[model samples]
Target chain A: MTDARRPLQIVDPDDPRIAAYRGIRERDLVRHQKRFIAEGTSVLRVLAGQRRFGIESALILENRFAGVADILGMLPAKTRVYVASSDVIDAIAGFPMHRGVLAVGLRRDDADAAPDTARRWRTVVALSEIANHDNMGAIFRNAAALGADAVLMDAQSCDPLYRKALRVSVGAVLTVPWHRFGHADAMLDWLETNGFALAGLSPRGDAALEHWEPPAKAALVLGTEGPGLPDRVMDRTQTLRIAMANGFDSLNVATSAALVLHHVRNARTGPASG
Target chain B: MTDARRPLQIVDPDDPRIAAYRGIRERDLVRHQKRFIAEGTSVLRVLAGQRRFGIESALILENRFAGVADILGMLPAKTRVYVASSDVIDAIAGFPMHRGVLAVGLRRDDADAAPDTARRWRTVVALSEIANHDNMGAIFRNAAALGADAVLMDAQSCDPLYRKALRVSVGAVLTVPWHRFGHADAMLDWLETNGFALAGLSPRGDAALEHWEPPAKAALVLGTEGPGLPDRVMDRTQTLRIAMANGFDSLNVATSAALVLHHVRNARTGPASG
Candidate 1:
């Protein structure tokens, strides 16, 4: 094992090697470099551990976080690991701290890999401007766990690799294969062309969730919290409304997605299978 | 209608009017205060739009936001509305911008309400720490939408009314009745005493979610993401594991709650019945 002291490379905030870690603002990364930050020991493990997520860089805290060091040791020796004082790390990230680790990676284009249709893929998720990172991450976590094959977000959605999202997902964001699509129209078009039946989740939808029969392949579309899927989107797909108690409006997008995903997954795979 | 012009309060950060918004450091708010912050028009609208929640205190951005006057005008005359310059508001909140509005509200304690008879309130949620405000908030949102009547949190849980919880919950935290029990033990005891059968969510659980028939009155207890509910808690309750794709470990806590809540609600009420 490469020891912490030997593996550690102390770098100031200005180190060009750590550019990905600097000025970790959402817009700056999205608009300027089209990248975002991922933090925590688990996310790093997921990225370096998984290998196919297209992660481009690594930045680890210099402290005695040997677990983080061990994880970094697994990465290619060429991967840049910047060890920083906790103060410098805080200043660079604009937060008090990360989970004793941080990394900056590319925001893969919204539509990166082509969706695999075969191999028993049944349920998937589509998101609108669900811009809250944590919600996005959680939804991904749910979709992955409920046997959803893919998670597609709209262009306006938050970067799932945002540090908060990574934490909220418990690093599931990295593990799950997620893509970004265009607006409702484009997403609808793609799903239709790809032979995936679509279901829009809406409170006012006439169909109840219990009656929702999952087609052989299905895509569940969820909108932002306040206003659900756009009217145009709902027009294109069958609507499934999760019945709620009176006076209660709706569930979080992620939570709603989970319920829908579970139903769809169950309908496709049969019961008691989870 | 009163014109929007008002004297901006140039009070120090220590001003008691903004006390509710104080100590909002992202981490300290979690560690020390056991809370996090949520700001802006959208979150507040969610809080206000929901009739079940109550207003705490408002920091109105003086004259900056057009079309907001009508909304502010509707507030009760006794409601504390602190008018501040956008700069002061932003500075006090430790953000570059304040979105022209902010409010601080107390965490709702719903546990005080008597748990209705098992037949009347067929579904319940028991949560472990789920300390992330967004997840906590999202869980409440799911519980309400999916027909879970009450939320019980163990000692390690996050403060649901913490601003982030309020925001993520879309103010559902205020509306959803939750109780803080000593821990899972106390919560489980209460559930059993109330004639509620307990279902613990775990990966190692023998009973899959689909296999278990929804009991007339049941409480589903969910633990954190990485570590599902403690073994002791699982030991006390019927362990139910959500089916998932083989590689994926588990759904996010809130999402799991939503899925289970949906199943329980659907089974008890019969879908379309709600």
Candidate 2:
């Protein structure tokens, strides 16, 4: 294929062009190198719909995929694509081919574009060490859906733009703005400085969820499952709990967040519906 | 190893002992055959704690898993416990071993054990074809925690007993009594015969959730993501919309169910606390 007309380049597995798709399952490569893979037509379709997320460096598909040529034609004139035998593509990725399409892109920083009014923000989500990409994505998806204005990740937070996170979010990560706070203390300072009420979601809190009304603009601080929010973080925030009947312990983090966000949103307006 | 106490088995890749865990990714076994997997120490602990769910066979770590052993001790003395090296276990499952424990359980037969009190039930959740195990588990977890009395599943519904579903539910699947309907018509007939009011959750519903004060007992039917409850189902049930801002399309089914369950629970008790 001529370079100008070929938006996608079909290459051999050994081609240096596809290095980004390698060793996705290796923890060290994933953690230290900060790279992952997004495969399949659905992910590509969603990524293409969001141009602002960034450039798609490579496209790998089976040679006979029906509409691969059409998608390649639609890419920005300069975009690079790769076509290979399904076996070759699977060999590079170490997994079976996904519906004959995959793309490699930069892992955008969670703090890529900060919210203008971070200082004035209320009803934010503070994530600490939430390493599971799917959970992180679900939280962002839920946060965006439930009207969370901002997201601040603590030191332990996973890359919000990781392919798994983005795919799980269904591209919501690109739309809902987020940032990172390297230090937990810095997060506390921001919450306090902004005059935001921080509701630390923990089982130890004295008040049941029904007992307290979320402030007009409050921040709901959620931590990873099991250990939950750290004591240091909770110390700076109001300790509130969702009441579970005897025997039950707590709700899933996203489910709990959704409950909290829903109530906080409801609180913004009068209870009785107009 | 003694056969009685050994509970130990070692097999090569070709051994039929690992058949159940094989080919998980190739086929939608959970959908086609109505099967699922339960995993990990947290899950085993939950299942053991809740006496209602049955204990099927299990794979246990031969070393460094005190929690798994503790849970296994609670299983029926006669139940088979296969012991293997962690690496062997990992290879058999096609994924990293989760705290050295996994169980396979039969799907609940809704027709056999649907609570007889459907006629007396006020709050209910009807899940239609929600394929994501995590979502299914989370929704059930939320429903159980939020005080929803019963759960009904349509034909397309994933088996809540599936392993991932159980893990996500924190074993609430066992604690929360549930029933399955053979078809949508069967579910509707049970609801109608029980004199239950149906609230179909959808984006286009005429009634906002805030305006809805679900009666002492009601059924909140939730459709899967994207195309919500079928129109016929919506027509038969009252449309209860969870109001959102302009840009957001809809909440995740699990998230939506949590909101509705909490709302209905609060409404039954009176207004939400501030």
Candidate 3:
């Protein structure tokens, strides 16, 4: 590759040009304000491939660069790529980043992005008060893998672009189309107005998931672990539950979402479908 | 409650009576050699109720004793309950034990325990090389919640009784019946002899999960992420795949188990069932 297109060598951990990649773990707290840190080679590939997020810069350990040359080669010439020694990289990140691959990407604000209500969707996932980063990431991964067209999280929900969430989602957080909305009430209203059937997963539900069928256009709504969906949200949507065999009803929110999303996706195309 | 049932007071962190509770995060590495630490009130409840495992001792923060009185009352008189200040408990744990409740239980050797081969089990989950404790724990939680009867892991798999696994499993590790066998071949042979139809989850499967129906007695086998089920095992069993959308087939092993288990459970009872 030409010098202009080659990755910039970053020897000093304190280099001002690569300041955006410094103290990643501590800096992650405020990362949602503008940018996201994509870790690991797989996540970085997704980051480079996606159009929704703009790559600001990449910091990679010297040894790992050759292995990821194909991915790095795809980046725009204007995108800065900082190569550093493992020690320098560790010093800048404030913790041992074993993955040795990092990318800072600017998140596209959804405030001006068009809502999915106008488009015909087969399956959509909506979340309320999903504050946990891992759970949020898992939900995005499940949604992306299970054929959900879009994801909508309430304003109170944790950002999917959070570094831990991004890593846990296996970079599905970048691949999946998602938006953050103002209120559960407004999102529910929009779904109904768009001729979409809303089904909320809860222990207390009107129908068992095995018996419930997703409408042609359905939005599966899920909530946080302990409290579940708010009373107002549950009241508006048709509540559905995965029947637990044992007396224990404990399931991680992400697992529950996967079960429900898989069921809804297959229910639409299964042999017994109406 | 009687005096014998009341929790005993232990002021010092170094008290030998509660030695099992000391430096738990580090002690966890070798905890499987003799005892397993069960954390939180919910997990403690499961430990107290189970017959397979025997509680060695319990360490509790003095103030939280009243809340878990019912669970404590169920424990055998022989089981010692040591109560200390939150600070003392934290010091003993080498970290903040925010849950304020813990129990070290002796794992019942499966060699003495009766095998469930004769028992007519509708579903069983088998795992191979699941080194990740959180994934192992999550699988146990899913199996317990979703109606799988038991879990079988290869000897190479991480111990389910590991502390982090126990915590992530929400104590489902205590509730679910599991066994670690010498090799995959031996486990597969035993499963077949027990009349189970083995179905291994893999990206390169013969049939899609949505279309496949579980046999009357089914054993759903799953492997670790990235490097999936071994070719030896996959060659022997019926291979299955969860159809992914957008060509992005990334689902956490635990979430994949949830999807497969949910489908098999529902398929057995759904309208399309035989």
Candidate 4:
């Protein structure tokens, strides 16, 4: 492991070595890339300890490097840390950087390589077409905090590794084991084969969540806010509703995930709403 | 009732009648004003239905008017409706408006005039100092959905009426009765006098939420993320913790509020975590 030391200094914004860091705010460009950007001190710290995702390199503000050198030191010896001035950093991102720390992380894509990703989880969260980055991030955060062992997202769902989602998840995406399925049926088949009971959340559900008892292994499948799960998907899973005070008070998609994930964790471990 | 008629045409962006709508993106000016902006069809719909927060007027895109005129028609007959071209709407906002519907709302400040505000709440969410608008909005949404009768915010907390907060809340702020206390002590005294048992959520809570039975009237006091509630506040309330899988996985402030509020509502109404 590399010990804390002076990081490489990049005085120029157009430095070819830091190509991946340039104009990162360009949404389309960042999306097609195989890697993901991690931002802020909290997320960077989580990335330092996790092995599920590999850290490619780090770009830090000159002043911020000192504050986070200890965290960077924990990465593999091959990990690169590039320190730059605020101007260079802002120019590279195509926007003024709010927090100083940024890093590119390589997705391991280990589900097919290693079945442990699918086999290990007792409590899972399967997301069906979540488009909002904030909601996507919140789902991962809730899953990690409530002890949902794995997170599975459909292909239509936005990338969890997106900078906003990564920061919002507070880097839980790094810690919690996750797999992105190419399609909804693939994810459903995997969950079914893995002995995970599928519980789809909807406005009109077959049973109230508390009233429905979970089996030994369970998966909480969350749908997008407005148009919930498709009939085909709901047909395969037990529809559970979070009964509200009135028809008007619709909970946010992320908020619903937190409530459901908490209930499943309770069923597997201890009390439901602790 | 206007009965969904064609809105008044706005050819120029600099129309003085729409001054409040001009350069609305300027954050500071939006604050310190008695009125607030409500954005998107969802928020506008809620504003139209509620009498507690009075609707001043509305600004809609020429193309988007027909889609939301029914919603706008629900407003009072005196409410002026302005329909502008995309250019004018974009120029007035200083950015391209994603959702065409925007409305100005008047804060009634009727807590003093009407004791019904203080007297009606059986369950309340008291925010200590929430800086994030998204979290603030989500808190209100969860409180409203989970049967929290009122929301109380300390002076330092961000305004729920802020555009992003209102939009993220799905306009729950308009539906849920709320008050902003000038100071922490005032909020504490109000809850105390109103017969609400204060429960401050902390990592090091005195009792697990599930085990601690809530009284008839209870208030869940939430602190800002990172630096949680101050000792002075926690000393007065029963400190509660959301038991997590590990110390590493931290819940978002709003996520914690949802869980705690769900638990409180369950205690008062039915089963916890439903």
lDDT of each: 0.70, 0.71, 0.83, 0.82
Worst 10 residues of 2 chain A by lDDT: A27-36
Residue B118 error for model 3, in Å?
4.4
Of the two candidates 2 and 3, the one with more favorable DockQ, higher being better, is 3
lDDT of 4 by residue, A7-76 (tens): 7888888899788888776752345356779999999999988787888899999988879978987888
Runs in model 3 lying further than 4 Å from the true structure: A1-5, A9-11, A110-113, A116-118, A271-274, B2-5, B8-11, B110-113, B116-118, B271-274
Off by over 4 Å in 2: A1-6, A9-11, A27-52, A58-76, A83-85, A99-101, A107-111, A115-120, A271-274, B1-37, B91-95, B104-112, B271-274
C-alpha lDDT (0 to 100) for residue B203 of candidate 1: 79
What clash pairs does model 1 have?
A110-A180, A274-B243
For every model in order, what is the iRMS?
2.2, 3.3, 5.4, 4.0
> Interface RMSD of candidate 4?
4.0
Each model's number of backbone clashes? 2, 15, 0, 0
Specify the CAPRI tier of model 4.
medium
lDDT of 4: 0.82
Cα lDDT tens digits for candidate 2, B117-234: 5555678887777777888888888888888877888877887776677788887787776777778768877887787788899987878898787865688888888888888888
Per lDDT, what order, best first? Answer: 3, 4, 2, 1
For lDDT, the strongest prediction is 3
lDDT of 3 by residue, A1-274 (tens): 4342477888888899988888887776773568778899989998888787889889889999999988988787788888889889998998887889999988767532357544867688889989888898888888888888888888888888889998888888877777777988888888888888999999887787777767988888999878888888888899987788667876788888888787776777673221
Writing each residue's lDDT as its tens digit, candidate 2 over A30-109 gives 54234445555545655555664555465556554456555455556566667677777777777776666676655555
Please report how far candidate 2 places residue B253 from its true position, in Å: 1.2
- Which residue window of length 10 is worst by lDDT in model 3 chain A? A109-118
